[model samples]
Target: MENLIIYPENQKQLQILKSLLEEMKIKFKSEEQVEELQDWQKEKILKGIKDIKEGKFSSNDDVSQKARECIK
Candidate 1:
């Protein structure tokens, strides 16, 4: 048995890795790091959630399109 840590940058990458793992039938378990968040970190996360609920977040496609426009 071997243990490895995988830190995916974002949810999309995480999903892709999960799909590949499933396709390959690899046995794996996911564990989120347990840590106490600072007061500021908690506030920031709450604000982000509120913004998402208020439809203030941009989608992946929107960000990618903006990046392409900047590159052009």
Candidate 2:
């Protein structure tokens, strides 16, 4: 892996890399590769949607006080 080096200094280079990596199925093995929030946040949103679907929680007044605080 030490032989691998990425220097995306130009649009052509980037496009070439995008194609080559896509063709080769080369994967990024680095921490920053995750690039966005992890699975827990996605799970929380899914759970909230499921709760709303199931009628498991809440009324407007439950959140209205917090919403009013935003105006202050």
User: What TM-score does each of the candidates earn?
Assistant: 0.50, 0.38
How far residue 65's Cα lies from its native spot in candidate 1, in Å, is 0.7
lDDT value, candidate 1, whole model: 0.91
Q: In model 2, which regions exceed 4 Å deviation?
A: 1-34, 64-72
> In model 2, which residue pairs have backbone atoms overlapping below 3 Å?
none
Alpha-carbon deviation at 26 in model 2, angstroms: 33
Instruction: Report the error of model 2 at residue 30, Å.
Output: 18
Off by over 4 Å in 1: 1-34
**What's model 1's lDDT at 41?**
98
Q: Model 2 Cα displacement at 41 (Å)? A: 0.9
Best model number under lDDT: 1
